[model samples]
Target: MAVHSLLLGVVQGATEFLPVSSSGHLALAQWLLGFDEAPLPFDLVLHMATMGATVLYFWRDIVDLVLEWLGGFVSARGRWSEGWRYGWAVAAGTVVTAFPALGLKPLVERMIHLPWAVGLALVLTASLLFAAGRLPRRGGQVVLSSGFFVGLAQGLAVIPGLSRSGATIVTGLATGLKSEEAFRFSFLLSVPAICGATFLELRSVGSWGDFTAALPSGWLVGAMAAFATGYFSLVLLRRVVTLGRWRGFSLYCLLLGLGTLALSVVRG
Candidate 1:
């Protein structure tokens, strides 16, 4: 179990920030490894670990946003600050994302167990990534409209094979935001999304007793591994986006999606 946890943790961390879907890889990894369904608490722990990595990586932006938001209530000048605008932009994106996520939650959960469906979604993700790469490089600011569209993409990525970072970042890029701005907003949006997911999972666990019972001592090892790997993955992804190499990942997703679909058909 410890080994399995470590393996899954590594898989989750490595894929989470890549254009490839982490949830898709995790589902496939578990299926191929014949591992049992991961407990809810452990899954939440792993997610939180990755979330922590994201936070640490963007700690400055987060702190600035928070301070600015608080200052908005205290001074008129703060209301017009850059950080205030950014905070509102993030809020708008989060609100936009929540709608589709809540509406599609059940369907996504059902699709998670269906490898063929996930494969199809991966193909769709690839298409989006490919299109993003081909878009004209007319860089723009991260406005409310761009934020909404990117958030919509993020919401759609609730599906197992739809990569959240890929979808959001690609959408931002295609919408004319600069690579660095797109990447920054993409991760900033993720902070809330991950927190919401953790909250939902925690609520579903019913009681502290059940949550405690579901967690294994070895889960800590997995969480630590996820944090370490996730931080490095974030660094790599930032460089990849900056270098405009995201299309390379699209090709990988395309082949993997097709192969997974074929395998699912054969097994059936």
Candidate 2:
């Protein structure tokens, strides 16, 4: 991969795992760089890199959950086993949240072309985070309603400048989950959601030949950078969340959104 593409991948990989909106920054970067294509394939590749990092970072959790879910799927009355019951809840949440998101892809793509639309979404994201920070924490309990609500928020984040982590974490907090729990669940929720999106894009291998041919070098660099940055970000976020400092991120988001809006108006 060329240096520019490598740098882009590094940016995507690092930012995607954090509460900051990777897509939003990437769009802005592309526009600033005067790149013709917005690098959808590259975005997918970066997502895949993050997914791999997630698996590495949370391998133990993933293994236990898979084992539990598999045990539940094979058994009758599924609830007979403790592991089986918890597994079903996760599966249910994953499936329920994914459907609406899948249904709305075309709509999201259409809206994303408008710069102001993305700017508005970023502002909305800031609002969600700000509100969530003010609420008192409740012990994290994963319930259907919480799952559904967070899923809806995640769907909304299809717009540029909306962070998936920020949306889900804010919703989780609003639902009264403790900050740590909210953060944990938000990260867990990302596994299936991001993986599904990546799989869909990767399935059509032919359309992405040029991108794929460049992947080996990019993937190595991107994956390592993502893993290093993501691991640290997760740890930092967990600590900051415990301290109830999510409000700082809201300020950051607000500034970025307003800046993007200003830039769009000036350029137009």
Candidate 3:
């Protein structure tokens, strides 16, 4: 594998869990490296790898939610269970956040090709991250309406520079959810959304083999690095959220956005 492939994996792993946008970072990285080829299926592999880790790490929570939903369907007192309500909140949030991105897929794809557009969006993402510090904190449980609002933020995050996690976390904070709750829910919600994206890519490309034929070793290295790095990133992010230290991430995004913009202008 090439050195850049390893770097790509690290970037994917590091940013995938952070409020910083992984896709946005990858886009800027690819541009900086001047890679002229398509990086789709391979990109999907890295994303899928992270998605798997997230699911594995949260398997119990996911399983409990499923069981609760199933039992509620079969039992009379199902509606009274906190598990059932939490499950619905998860599902509702997923639908609210992901649906608009699906609807705007074409538009996002088109805009991402324009570096200037991506640069502008990255600036906006930086602004949101910065604003997170000013948002009021919610006590605990996330309200149902908050889901839609967060989803709307996530929808805008389809742009290359915007961090899905950052957008969602900021939205959650703005809606009054505590940082830890906001972070946890953001990760949990990412499972389905990332899977849906990977699946859509695979469907269009036919299979992993097609992508592998061009860059097998690079893809494998990227995936492994992504998994290892992402696992640790998730753990660290949880701790930071618990400590209410999200302001640093805001600064990081702002600096990164500015740096990318500077590079773009220099190259032109």
Candidate 4:
């Protein structure tokens, strides 16, 4: 069980930020390992770890945006600040994301048990990544409309094999945002989605005691492993996006998606 947790943690972290789908990888990993879905508590912990990694990676931006946004209430100049606009963009994105996400909950849950569907979704992700690489820089700012469209992409990515980061980043690029800005905004937008999901998981967990009973190590292994790898993956992905090196990830997703589909057929 510990070994399984460790391996899944590694997969979760490694794929989470890499334009590859973490949910896809984790679901496929669990299926291949012949395990039921991970315990609810540990799932929460792993997600929180991802959230922590994202927060740590972009702490400065987050802090500055937050402070600047907050200052807007007291000063007109602050209200027109970049941070204030960026902050509203984030909020707008989150709100738009919630609609499709909630509406598609049933389908997303069904994707969990359907590896072939997940594989197809990964192919979609690869297409998005490949296109993101070729898009011209629109040099657009992260305004409400751009953010809203990106959020729609994020919402659709709730499907198992679809990469949330891939979807949002590509959508941002398609909307003419700079590559670096797309990358940064995508992750920042994820913060709220992650928090909302984590909150729901916590509410569903019932008791903390159930978590301890399931883990001899008290969920520390998954959390630590995920956080460590997730942080570095963020660092690596930032470089990859800024350098226009997205083709490699696009190819990887394509191959993985095809392979997963092939394996499912054989297993049947």
Candidate 5:
């Protein structure tokens, strides 16, 4: 169980930001390991660990954005700060993402049990990346509408094969933001989303105490590995996005999707 957790942790952290579907990859890993599905407690732990990595990576921006946004209520100068606008944009995006994502939660879990469905979703993710790669890059800032659209993409990305970062970054680009800005905002936007997910997972577990007591083997090592690998994955993804090299990720997703589908066929 520990070994499985370690591998899944690495998979979760590594792909969570790389425009590849982390959930899909996890499903493949679990399938290969002879597990029917990942246990909920373990899933929650992995999510929190990876979320921690994202928070640490962007801690500075997060602090500034939060402080500036709060300060705006009392200071006129604070209202005009970039952080204020970006903060609201993130909030708006989170609201927009809530509807579809919440509505599809049940379906998303069901899809996790279907490997072929994950493969198809991966194909969809590849297409989205390909389209975004073709769009012209711009230096525009994120606004309410941009947040809304990207949120919509993120909402739909709750599906196992869909890539949250890929979908949001693509939508961010289509909305005219520059590659780096889009990359930054995409992860910034993820903070609340992950928090919300963690909350839900906690609720589903009934209580943190009960949840912790029954934690599966290897959780600590798995979580630590996840955080470590996830941090580096963020660094690698930053370079990839800044270089406008999404087509490479696109190709990777395409091949992986096809291969997953092929394996499904052969096994069935």
Candidate 6:
């Protein structure tokens, strides 16, 4: 169980920020490993670990945004600062993302255990990434319009095999934002989305007593692994995006999607 937990943690952390879908990988990994579905508490814990990693990695940007907003309010200059504007853009994107997410929640949940469905979604994700890579690079800030579209992409990515980070970042890039800016906005937007998901999962817990009763030591070890790997993955992905290596990931996703589809058919 400890080994299983650690393996899943690594999967969640490594793939969560990549163009590949973490949930899809997790579902397939569980199926292939013959492991039972993870409990809500354990899943939540793993998510929280990754969330913490995000916060820690982007703490400076977060602090700058908060301080800039406060400065805008306190200063004689009534105009909003650049950071505040970007912050609002992130908020707007999050709001837009919620719409489709709310509607797709049931559908996504239903497909979570369906390997074939995940495989299909991975193919779609690959197409999106491939197209995004072909788009000419443009330099621009993340405006409300770009944010809305990116948000829509993010919401659509709730499907099991579609990666939220991949979808949103690619959408941002496609909309003319620079790679680094797009990556930054994509992750900043995720902070709220992840928090909301964690809250919803926690709220659904029937009993704290029962939930904690079966807590395993492996859970903590898994979470720690997630945090460590998540941080490194973020760093690696940032470099990959900056270096125009997104197409490499697109090819990987394409191959993986095809392999998964083939495996599903053979098993069936």
- Could you give the C-alpha RMSD of every candidate to the true structure, in order shown? 1.4, 2.9, 2.2, 1.4, 1.4, 1.6
Worst 10 residues of 2 by lDDT: 81-90
TM-score versus the correct structure, for each prediction: 0.95, 0.86, 0.89, 0.95, 0.95, 0.94
Write model 6 residue lDDT over 182-228, tens digit each, in one string: 99989888899899888988888768896776556589888999999
Which parts of model 4 are misplaced by more than 4 Å?
Answer: 216-218
User: What's the residue-level lDDT of 180 in candidate 1?
Assistant: 92
Candidate 3 displacement at residue 176 in angstroms: 2.2
State each model's CA lDDT, in order: 0.87, 0.71, 0.75, 0.86, 0.88, 0.85
Two-way lDDT contest, 1 vs 6, winner: 1
The TM-score measured for candidate 5 stands at 0.95
**How displaced is residue 209 in candidate 1, in Å?**
3.2
Check candidate 3 and list the clashing pairs: 138-176
Among the numbered candidates, top lDDT falls to 5
**Which stretches in model 5 have alpha-carbon errors above 4 Å?**
none
> Residue 32 CA error for candidate 1 (Å)?
2.6
Instruction: Answer with 2 or 3, whichever has the higher TM-score.
Output: 3
The residue-level lDDT of candidate 5 at 82 comes to: 82
- State the lDDT of candidate 5 residue by residue for 1-268, as single tens digits: 8887788788889998889989888777777667546678888888899999999999999898899889998999998988888888889999999999999989988988788899999999999889987898789987778779988989999999999999999889988999989999999999898899788778878766888877778889889989999999999999988888888889999998999899999999
Give, for candidate 1, the lowest lDDT window spanning 10 residues.
28-37
Tell me how many clashing residue pairs each candidate has.
Answer: 0, 0, 1, 0, 0, 0
TM-score of 6: 0.94
Off by over 4 Å in 3: 36-38, 207-211
Q: What's the residue-level lDDT of 97 in candidate 4?
A: 92
Please, what are the lDDT tens digits per residue for candidate 2 over residues 108-127? Answer: 77655667667777887788
- Supply candidate 5's per-residue lDDT for 27: 76
Taking all chains together, the TM-score of candidate 3 against the true structure is 0.89
